[model samples]
Target chain A: MLSEEDRRKGAELLLQAERERKPIPQLSKTFPDIEIEDAYRIQDYWAQARIAAGARVAGHKIGLTSRAMQLASKMTEPDYGRILDDAFYNDGARIPASRFIKPRLEVELAFIMGEDLAGPGVRIYDVLRATEFVVPALEVIDYRTEVPRAITDTIADNAAFGSIVVGGRPVRPFDVDLRWVGATLSQNGIIEETGVSAGIMGHPAAGIAWLVNKLHVVGTGLEKGQIVLAGSFTRPVDITAGDIIQVDYGPLGAIGVSFI
Target chain B: MALDWKTLEAFAEHLENAELERRAITKITDDCPDLSWEEAYAIQDCIRARKVARGVRITGLKMGLTSLAKMTQMGVEDPIHGFITDYGMVPDGGEIAMDALIHPKVEAEVGFVLKRPLSGPGVDIDMVLAATDRIVPAVEVIDSRYRDFRFDLKSVIADNTSAARYVVGSSTTPFAASDLHRLNVVLEKNGSVVAEGVGATVLGHPAASVAMLANMLGRKGEGWEVPAEALILTGGITEAVPVARGDWIDVRYKDFGSVSLHFV
Candidate 1:
């Protein structure tokens, strides 16, 4: 556990890293006893600060939901992060490379909820019923901390969420089988990764259900009109300036973004 | 505001040519910025006339974006309708020529063969079921005539909701024989399951999509009714799965048999 003072300091460090687009040393290194709860507290402090500064929380993002992702990250469970309004982009957006440090991209499906969802036992059926549509999206992940970072450090850094680019055809949740939704990611016209949404813990909505239940533990829930990015299915692909990233979601359509 | 018949015809021809050539053009709305919904439907009617003049028979109609998910994804608030031509038919377990489509994607649907003509300003689910003679498994191949499949409602309506080709299953069942809302559908590509959905995926009940279609047509004007013996594809039950040449697509409809097609 971290002292409240230590948590505040960690929040400041993350904020500074984001503001300067520079990576900072891991928080776990400084506070060896920092617990997952402490890390969440630090994240909450940072999120509150941002919200107070006029950045609204648009929705939540669940990360590390897939077993493959969990194994790759050496984490046992998924983590949640806030998606701020300023970090959202549309398809074909040209984003400045300098906005993030050591960014990577992952293809995902975003759910736009039509009704508020809170849960102690929110199931996939509830998510399906509440979802207005599902659209293809690309998550820009930026590790604000230096390497050798622990899970606590990552959790405090808002699960490495930087921004998101959503595009492609939206389909009603029931219109298509969400589990079989496939995404093919390409950079500079070369295919880099391919995967199906079922990788997100058997089904993409399963992750949303997990998130809702997790949030309900803290008396919060997914709100209507919010965009929730279910965890990514494909492995993260490194990105750089001048890179053109496109994700083809088959019948769901396609979305592309360029970094400059 | 209303558009002149000449302008609507020109737009219709532009879209018809794109469809015939299997080429994509920019959305029609880019040229006709102020095109209204009525004008868009007029243009669509004009396209249908041209096809009929060329000996193509209108076999049925289809609903697109009928589900809330589809509407949200397309950024549209309402569902759209389009015509299905006899030339668009691909037999079950048959092949679809890849060269005849721009970029095609297949979606599983429930096909309704009507026995009684149905029109609506107030059509409901019961009325739709009463008029439907049989419900069969179906797969619709949608290929937008707009470059990149990007278009607004007006543009998509003018392009016939990207309707390309479709295959209906051989077996037919009474609409009341099964629970339409709970029927499961699994779509496979190359022997692997690529998509799965339920009959409820099409606006709660597939019949609801047909009802909405009838109502939309009634609202359009007089003398517009889904004719008897017409086959109506109750929109896509699952998201359209992309296909390529040599790919085999199969859709399994629970209790209703299956539909298969190959892209050649």
Candidate 2:
């Protein structure tokens, strides 16, 4: 177990590094004495600090859920972190890139809850019963760590959820075969990325089931009215300060954003 | 605070202690400029210790910047990952205040649940199916904590990728009947078609993404033993769009139903 002293010290160190724009060494080198569990302790402290600073906990983001992502990050497992209220955005609007250090965009599906979802024996049917609707969303991913972070380093940081865009077309959970849903991502009127909803774990909501089960193991559950980015279909698009990014979803409609 | 094996059995002990001391002193002391990486880890070590005390269980992890475009934008070749916690889940159709997040963003994605255990190093689509469970619809809300949400890959990873809000719709489909590669997804703003996409775009299929995840972790000797019930997110289907206040974004999965969100 991490002691209060250690938690505070770790947060201070990270805060200091961030303040001075310094880098933290990998746990393997800096503290051969540290363990995965210990690294999470620092993450907890970081979350606490955010909470203490008035950040309201929102939802959780799953990262490195794919093999390609793990290989790129040089890590082997998925990571997660908290979402706060101050970071949320809406549809048909301008998101000033100035609010982000280095912001990137991704197209994804969004889910609305109809009932309560708890962990520990939560079934797919339960998720369906609890869900009220589904829609297209754009996830803005921003990071807080250094460039080219090791898996362990990333774990210490949250999953890098910069902001989110939701509320487009509302599809009934049972009305359509999610696997058949498709999307095309364009930048400056040019297609850059494309894919279908099935790319996100067969059916998009399946990712949420994974998230719920994962959280249940930690004694958590999914509440109503929260937004979960089921996962991405295409590789993320490169977003520039003045780029007009658009994600087209055939029948469900389309969403666009301009970085300024 | 001696650093020895026996004394450091709980390594968190020394780290946490030192951190508290530093925290107390730093408030009064002049901010130390140019702290070393070793020093940063020292503090990280301490925070990890305290988390254990809080009983915050370690859930799964996530990778960021996996997309070629994201990597190029960040000026880095590799992606970054972070951890998810039990306290992060939110409900669909619920009200969310925007004041708590740093710079939040949202996206649409398909979620997968496993029916059996699957590991990496040699896992494939067949493996994903053999171990498949029910599938559902979902949406992810991302929010960064950095000032103006600015940071490099490493810094973002440390900040947990700004993960924030999320909602899963009440819809389930059998994996066998699910045609992931051909699936069509649409994002609507104010009831208008704004974005569209398909499933094949996510590394071929979302299940393939899972196979990759298993294999990646296998190399670390900690690959997922994916039980009969494990949820996995398969990356984004389209590019992320910007949002503002009082907007309603809906994501419709052609055959899987739809989910929506209202930002106030």
Candidate 3:
């Protein structure tokens, strides 16, 4: 575990890197003794600084829910990150590519909760019942630090979050089978990736159930009216300036954005 | 012809769900064309009972569709009533999240804070003024759960007169019927005055709506009456104007001061 000073330095480095639109060396290299708890503390410190500076905690994002990734990392639990309102954008938004450093996009489902969800034994049914609706979304994940990054580095960097763009048809949690919902990611008129909602830990809301339980250990819980992004179903597609990204969820509708 | 108790419960459930989910659904009247006004009020009561059971405090009641223009436009003779909740209270000059509402519109209104509990079968404007406390400027944010804001009187009544949120001004004035007479009403959006009218447009006197509300309640099942110390919103004075994200709304009541809101 790193010392308090070390965690503060790590958080400052990540925040400065993001502010300057620059990527720093992985924190794991800077603090070889960094622990997962330290990473989260550093992330917390980073979030506190931002919130103190006027950024709001809009919601949360869950990542590393894929079985293959979990097996590769030998982790049994999914990781979480706080979503800042500063990074929120609506569908068909014209985003300036200059705002991010080497940004990439992921296809995911976003659950907007209607009620507070607490942990310890929160079930999938509870998540569904609490969720107001599900909508198609695009998560732009950008690295604030260099690659060859360890879990500590990623966690401290807010799960590599950049921003999120949400649009398309919103359906009630029980309006249709969530697992069967599918979408295709298109970039510059080419279909790059396609995925089913089930790819997110067998069901998109299952990760939220995990998130709520995990938060309970820390005396925290998912707040009412907060958005929760289920982990990506498709691989992150590289994005650059002047790229047009469109994600089609078939009958549910499509979300389109411009990178300029 | 009254519907079964189970049907009322189901309608209440759907209406509440649409509100909580912030999604619009077809009007209930579309499915049941013969749905009576009394049945609509029953469904509304069921919705109110559900809210009360959940511990959501009913702060005040609102009178809607009372303006002569609104009544003529909707072809209605009487104003409809609905209750507001504590969760729906927006502070003066506060921001409202657009995502929390389906499609919101703002109405310039006056809120009557009662000094004493008054009930009536023959409540008149003089009686309403006699029991009054102070009057405050208010902007009622009406958001209908019906798709495209298309709903009959009966449908809207069951949907709580499309009440989503409300803002009460920090300033207040003592009750006087003459003070409300011919007062200039203005609604500004994004720094531009878009709507204007006279305060008397709300059925000659704003207090008249409260009397109407009290009388209507007196005619309801078992004669329901409004309790004392309640803050009641009179019907809209000017036309209700549509609002959206990034829109700054400022409603000025000639002498009652102004209530402003920023949408985000």
Candidate 4:
């Protein structure tokens, strides 16, 4: 357990790094005693500070739900973050390249909920029942901390969510087999990666179900009309200025973003 | 025929999702040919409820098609109202993404910030000006979720009058010191003038639009009123100008300076 002072200091470090657009040393290196609970405390402090500064919480995001991601990160658990409204961009938006430390893109699906969901036993069916629709989205990941981060360090940094670009046609969860939904991500007209939604914990909604049950332990739940970016299905793709990213979701439509 | 609450909510979710995802769909009227104005408003109310439930703050209300010219252009005789949320506001000189809209157009108008609550079936321009704290130049970016921006009155109303984003100018002109009816507005795109009109183009006077909105809301019996400190956008004074990526829109108000935006 981290002391209250240490938790605040951890939050301040991450916040300062974000504001300055500079990466700092991992929190795990400085706070060797840091636990998952302490990491969440630090994230909560930083999120509250951002809200105080006039940013609204638009949604929540789940990360590292895939076995591949877990293996790559050397972590066995998923992490979550508060998605702020300022971090949302329209499709084909030219995002400023200077706003991130080391920005990368991940292809994912976003669930827009129609009803509030809470639970210790929330299941895939519950997520489907509560979901209004699923739309294609691009998660902009930025690291505010140095490389070689631990799970505790990543959670404290808001799961590395910099922003999200939402576009494409929305479909009801039952309208299509979400597990088979596939995406082809291209950069500058070159295909970089392709994957199916099943890579997200078997089914995309499964991650949302997991998040709801997890949040129940903290006395919070997913609100009605909130957007949830389920875990990314593909590996992170490096982005650079003047790069145009297009992710085709086949019949679900497509989403694009330009970094400038 | 009366529509059930559940059906109205379903339609609201459908339309709201289109707006949020920046995708276009066929107008609702095409599917429900006999939809009534009351039912349209009900669906709009459902949209407002969903947004509020999602933690979106209601910043104000907006009136669309208040001008006789706009009514004639759209072949509609009455105006429509829609709620504006915090997400709908864009900073001056901000960049609007083209991908977030199906087909977007810009309109020059005046925005009213009220100092007192105004509700009525008998509210007039005098009462509107008396309640107003400041009036600022504004440019509204209207993006219809309907395919090709073609929709009937009922369809457009339920779609929130095609409201997407708006920017309020920094300069606030007092109502008493300015002559709104005679004020000319020039809308320029990329340094070239596109459309120009006087404030009188908006229902004789811009304040008349707000007065009409209050009367309309009061008659609906929804308990909805223009609250104090609410920002009300009067209907467009000029015809809508189409915009695209890399376009810079500048609306110059006669006395209230100007508001500009970029589409990127």
User: lDDT by residue for model 1 over B128-205, one digit each (tens)?
Assistant: 887878888889999999999779888998888889899999765444523676665667788755555556657767
lDDT of 3 at A209: 98
Could you give candidate 2's per-residue lDDT for residues A39-133 as a string of tens digits?
Answer: 66676787788789888877666665543465577665556666677777776678887666457787788777777687776666677778888
Q: Candidate 4 — which pairs collide? A: none
Model 3 per-residue lDDT tens digits across residues B32-60: 78899999988998999999999999999
**Residue A234 in model 4: lDDT:** 68
Worst 10 residues of 1 chain A by lDDT: A190-199
RMSD of 1: 14.6
DockQ of 3: 0.01
Give the 10-residue window scoring lowest on summed lDDT in candidate 2 chain A: A25-34
Docking category for candidate 1?
incorrect
lDDT of each: 0.85, 0.62, 0.84, 0.85
TM-score of each: 0.56, 0.49, 0.50, 0.50
Cα lDDT of model 1 overall? 0.85
Better of 1 and 4 by DockQ: 1
lDDT of 4 by residue, A1-260 (tens): 89999999999999999999999999999899999999999999999999999999988999997765677688766889989999999998999978999999999999999999999999999999999999999999999999988989889999999999999999999998887566767677645555567667767898899899989999999999899999887678888899999887767898988999
**Could you tell which candidate, 1 or 3, scores higher by TM-score?**
1
Task: Supply the TM-score for candidate 1.
Answer: 0.56
Using TM-score, rank the candidates from best to worst.
1, 4, 3, 2
